[model samples]
Structure formats: structure tokens, C-alpha cells
Target: MSVIGKMLTLLRGSARELGESVVDANATRIYEQEIIDARNAILKAKSELTGVMAKEMQSAREIERIRAEALRLEDLALEALGKGKEALAEEVAVKIAETEQQLEEQSRVHADYALQVGKLKDLIKSAEAKVREHEREVAIARTTESVYKATRSISDNIGASGSKLLNARESLDRIKRRHEELADRMAAAESLDKETGTRALEIKLAEAGIGGDAERARRVMERIRARKTDAEGQ
Candidate 1:
């Protein structure tokens, strides 16, 4: 194919795919609409079937009327023959034959109507059964779609919550590390202060001649001086 033709084909494919995607997305709605359409069709068929049945009944009534007329004519022909009227009886017999023929034709028509009505009824029944099954399937599809949406929402929320929990845990860990570092610094500072304070107090005592080897040396020197002066005086 030429480039333009290929491009057109690609566009057509993409369009088809897009259409299918949209249809799939709204499949449940479409199925429900289809069920409604099927029900409407069944109702229309039933109405038509009712008309056919009415015609069949009318045909049956016509047949009965013809049969009654034939019976009445037969009785009239019998009375005419009993009264010695051959021509009138012959005329009555012709009417009886005509009525019988009419009855036969009406009965055939009625039978045909009855057959059509039966077939239509069976077809309508089967169509209704199929529609009912489709309705049930649509119901199940709707329920399943709802369940899938709920599950998807829950899964999305769980994923988001999991991320948030991870962030919170990291923040907690950082806080703990900072607190531990601060505690260490404070402990080091406290130890250094104690060492510095003790050294400063010892230096002050030594300068005031109050505590250590220097004071003991001064006392020994004073005792030696006193003994020498006593020996010279004696």
C-alpha cells in the first residue's frame, strides 16, 4: 500500500479500537438497553399474535354459523319433501350444499389461523425466555462491574496509604536519629563541664596554700629554724 493508504488504514484501526474501548467501558449500560429493546420486541410480537388469534376466533365463529345454516336448510328440505314439494326441496338441498362448502372453507381458514397463532405463540415464548436469560446476565454483569470498581478503589487507596505510611515511618526514623544525636552531644558537654569545674577548684586551693605538698614543706622549715635559735641561745 501507498503511505497515504497505510496512514488511512492506521487511522481506521485506531478509530475502531477507540470505538471498541468506549463500548467496553459502557458494556453494562449497553447490555441493559439491549434487554429493554428485546422486551419491547417481545411485547410487539405478542400484540401481533393477539391480532392473529382474534382472526382465528372470528373464522371459527363463521364456520359455526355456516354449519348451523346447513342444518336448518336440511330440516327445511325434509319438511318440503314431506309436503310433496320437490322443487322447493331441491332448492333447499342446493343451499345445504352451498352452506357445507362455506363451512369447509371457513374451517380451513380457521385452522390456518390457529396454526399461525400457535407458531407465533411458541416463538414469542421462546423469545421471552431468551430475554429473561439476558436480563439475568445483565444483572450479574452489573453486579460484577460494581464489585470490580469497589475492589479497584480499595486497591488504589491501599497503595496510597502504603506510601503515606512509608513516608511517616521515615519521618519517625529521622526524628529518632536527631534525638539520639542531641542526647549524645548533651552528654559530652555535661562530662566536659564536670572535668573543667573540678580542675579549677583544685588550682584555687593550691594557690591559697591550703591543701597539698607545699603546705607540708613550709611547716617542716619552721620547726628547723626554731631548734637552731634555741641551741645558739644556750
Candidate 2:
């Protein structure tokens, strides 16, 4: 790879790491907040339950006081009845029955409130567990995402390097072709030089008025005729 390509690869790797770090940090914050909210909800539910219990206790005390008062009134009515005050005794009996019914209703209400508080605690626990599971999922997703990003970055970098190498090869091919063309031109020039030298020698001989000798020309013609005769015989 070229220097620039190496640098790009390094930069892409760093970017992937940075992205992963950011996701991890965000996930941590989200998980922390979820935990805090769940804990707060649990604390609030407990506090409310504490207050409800205190109220229930007060109600119980009031019911006990009413029972005591009803007994005292009954005792007074019985004493009066023994003295022939039957109407006063009947009034006291009615008041005692009404107070007993009110106490029963208050007890039922207190029990219902306690049940509701228990359900709230269960819900908080479930929510906290869900938050933890979600955090784990987020961590896994971040890991996969980081791996995918890094792989993609590396693949792209490798592809770019391959393209550059191909381009370099093409450039070298062009240089080689240019060199071949120059060599061919040189060869042509050399051939032309040889041709020019031959033509110049012919002109020099003609200018010097040098013609072939009669005896030599006759000998050369005899050799040609002999060759033609041999071909005909064959």
C-alpha cells in the first residue's frame, strides 16, 4: 500500500474505535439512569407503605377506643335498664353496632392498600431486571457494530489500494509502449541511414564516370545464362 493509503487505513480504524467508545459511553449512561430510576421508585413505594402502615395503626387505635367507649356506654345502659330505663339501653346497643361495622370497613381498606404496595414492589423489581437485560443487549449490539464498521473500513481501504496498484501498472505499461515506439523509430532511422549511404555511394560512382568493364559484364552475363539453362534442364 501507498503511504497515503496506510494513513487512511489507520484513520478509519481510529474512527471505528471512537464510534464504539461513544456507543459504549451512551449505553453506560442509559443503564445507570435506568438503575437509578428503578431504585428511586422502590424507595418511594417503601416510603408510601410506611405512611400507610402508620395510618392503619392509628385507625386500629381509634377502633379500639370506640370499642372501649361502647362497652362503657353498654354498662351504663344495663345499669339504667335494671332501674327500668329500657329505651336508653336500646340506643346504646345501636351505637355499638354502627361503630363495629365502621371498624371492619377500615380494616379491609388497610389490607387493600398493603396488597397494592406489594404489587408495586414486584413491578419495580421486574423493571430493574428488564433494564439490566436491555443493557446487555446494547453491549452486544455495540460490539457487533464496531466489528462490522472496522471490517468494512478495512475492506474499502484494501480495494482502494488495489485500484491504485492497477493504475500504477497501467502507467508503467504506457511508459513501456512509449519506449517501444521510440525504439522502432530509431530502427527505422538506422535503416534509412543505410539506404542513404548506399544511394550516396551509387551517385559518387556515377559522378566519377566509373562504368562496369566489358570483360567483367560479359562474365556476369555468362553466369546468368548458365543458371537459366540449369533451371530449364531441371
Candidate 3:
């Protein structure tokens, strides 16, 4: 491989890492926003419950006052009847009956209000449960996110390291190719010298009666001419 190819590989790996980081940050931000929204909903539910309870208490107090006024008017009517003033006593009795009816109606309204308050309290309780559920969901999501982040970190490190190793291997291969080329050139340069040394050794051997140099040279020349003829035919 060439230097340019190795550089491009490194750049691509770095870009992948950057992309992964951006995605992780975006996910974390989204979870954070969800947590904030859940908290706000819990607070709002609590505030509304407080206001409802306050209004319920005020209604209860008004009902109690009406009940006390009804009892007082009834006592007044009895005292007037005992004094032998029939017409005035009858008027007081009528007023007492009206007050009693009003009190009864107020009592029913108060009871209804109390029931509504209880339902509101139950609603608040349900809201609290929802808040708890949201919290648990958030915790689980966070745990999953942590695992994902850890896995991604491991993958990123491995990818970076593998990229470096590939670059190194490409460098080594290029160097090895250059070394082989140099060796081939050097071998070619020594070929003539090697042939001259062999010829000299053959001449000494022939002088010592091992064989004649003329015969050896003739055989060698014949072999070379045979190879040339074969090449020309091909």
C-alpha cells in the first residue's frame, strides 16, 4: 500500500469516532430533558392538590357555621312559643324550619365536597405512583445507556488500534518490496563477476589435467546457442 492510502484510512477512522461521539451526546441530552419534564409534572400535581385541600377546608368551615346558626334559631323558636305569643312564635318556627332546610342542603354540599376532596387526594396518590414509575424508567434507561457507552468505547478503541496496525503493515510491505528490488539489482550486478570466477576455476582445473578448458567452453557455448535457438523458435 502507498502512504496516501494509509493516511486516508486514518482519516476515515477519526471521522467515525467523531460521529459516534455526537450520537452519544445527543442521546444523553434527550434523557436529561425527559427527566426534567417528569419532575415538573410531579410538582404541578402536588401544587394542585394543595389548592384543592385548602378550598375543601373552607367549605367545611362554612357548613359548620350554617349548622350552628340553624340550632340557635330553633332554640329561639321554642322560647317564643313558651311565652304565649302565638303569631310571633309561629313566625320564628317558620324561620327555624327554613334555616334547618338550608343547613341540610349545606350538609349535603359539604359531604359532596369532602368526597371530591378524597378523590383529589387519590388522584395525587396516583400521580405520585406515576412519578415513581417514571423515575424507575429513567434509571433503567440510564443503565442501558451506560452499557451502550461502554461497548462503544471498547469498539472505538479497537477500531483505532486496528487502523494503526493496518497502517504499520502497509508500511512494512512497502519497505519489504523496496528491499527485494534492491536485492534483485545487486544480484544482477554480480552475475558477470560470478561467471568470470567460474571460468578462471575451470582453466586451473584443466591445466591440472582434470579436463580441457576447450572442451568445457565448447559445451557451454553449445548449451547457450541451444537456448537462443529455442527462444527464437518460440
Candidate 4:
């Protein structure tokens, strides 16, 4: 890959890793928030239940008052008849009939309310039991969150330390490369200096008349000594 393309790839990889690390590190907080939300939902449910229970209580009291009024009307009608007041008795009989009708309708309504109250109670009981059970779950979740948080914290620290180490290693490698280059340049400079000194010395020797002929004479004498030495050995 091109240098820029390679760099972009590295950046993308690093970003992805960072995002994953952040999510892992914060998972505990997310779970804790969820638990809080669940508790809040239970509180809201109880609040609504309280309102409904209040209305139910009011309705129960009203039913009782209506039932008591019906009883009173019946007693009044019987008393009127016992007093030998026929017209009064007749009037009271009509009132009793109307009261009885009202009582019947109220009773039907009260029966429905009563059944609903029982169901509401059962529902509340079930919900409370579920909430209590969920409390245990929440407690366990809290412990899990703590464990995950500790693990994530250690992982994050290790990851950060690894990144720093990688950067330090890269920097050390670059410094080593630079030092090698400097050493190469210094070696080249020293080699060039040696060559220049050798050439200058040869020029000076030639000026002093010792460049070629004198060296050739020395080689000739060396060959003569080699022949004599070989002849003696034989």
C-alpha cells in the first residue's frame, strides 16, 4: 500500500480499538443505569396503583352508604303500614320500590368494582413479588458490574501501556536507523580521507622520483633473492 493508505488503515484500526475499549469500560455504568430505570418503573407502577386503590376505597364506601339507605327506606315503609296510614304506606311503598331498584343497580356496579378490586390486589401482589425477585437480580447485576468494571479497568490500563510501549519501540527503532545512517556517513568520510591521503602521498613520491622505477628495481632484487634461495634448498 501507499504510505498514506497504510497510515489511514492504522488510524481506522486504532479508532475501532479505542471505541471498543470505551464501550467495554462503560458497560458497567450502562447496566447500573438500566437497573435504576427498572426500579423507577416499579415506583411508577406503585404510584399509579395507589391512585387506583384510593378510587376503589371511595367506591367501596359509597356502595356501603347506598346499601344502608336502601335498608332505611324498607324500614320506613314497614313502619308506615303498621301505623294504619294507607296513603302514607302507599307512598312509602313506591319510594321503597325506587330505592330497591337503585340498590339493585348499585349492587351490580359494586359487584363489578369488588371483583376489580380483588383482581387489582392480586395484580399488585404479583407485581410486588416480581419486583422483590428482581431486586435479587439487581444485586447480582451490581456485583457483576463491579467485576466487569475491574476487569475492564485492568484491560484498559494494559492496552494503554501497550500502546505507549509500541510508540517507544518505534521511536527507538527510528533513532537506531538514524544512528546507523550517521555511522555509514562517517565510515564513508573516513574511507575518502584515506584514499585522498594515499593519492597525495603517491604524488609526493613521484615528485621525489620514487613512484615507478625504484619500486620496479626493488621487485627485481626480490626475485633474484628468491631464485638463489630456491637453488640452495635444492
TM-score for candidate 4, residues paired by index: 0.41
lDDT of each: 0.76, 0.70, 0.69, 0.67
Full candidate order by TM-score, most accurate first: 1, 3, 2, 4
State each candidate's clash count: 0, 0, 0, 0
Candidate 1 per-residue lDDT, tens place, 68-175, comes to: 888889999999999999999999998888888888888889989989998888888887877776676556545544655666677679887875335778899999
* Residue 194 miss distance in model 2 (angstroms): 90
Estimate, for each residue in 135-180, the C-alpha lDDT of model 3 and write its tens digit: 5544554554465578788778988787533577889999999999
Clashes of 4: 0
Q: What tens digits encode model 4's per-residue C-alpha lDDT throughout 38-113?
A: 5666676567667666766776777778778878877887888899877997887788788678767766766776
Report the Cα lDDT for residue 42, model 2. 68
Q: Judging by TM-score, tell me the better candidate of 1 and 2.
A: 1
lDDT tens string, model 2, 1-234?
A: 443453345446755555534344565577668767866776786787677667767766776777788688778878978989888878877886886777688678767766766776677678667667656655655665577678768768988788533577889999999999999999998888766877666666666655545556768899999999999999
Give candidate 4 regions above 4 Å deviation. Answer: 1-37, 128-135, 138-234
Native-referenced Cα lDDT, model 1:
0.76
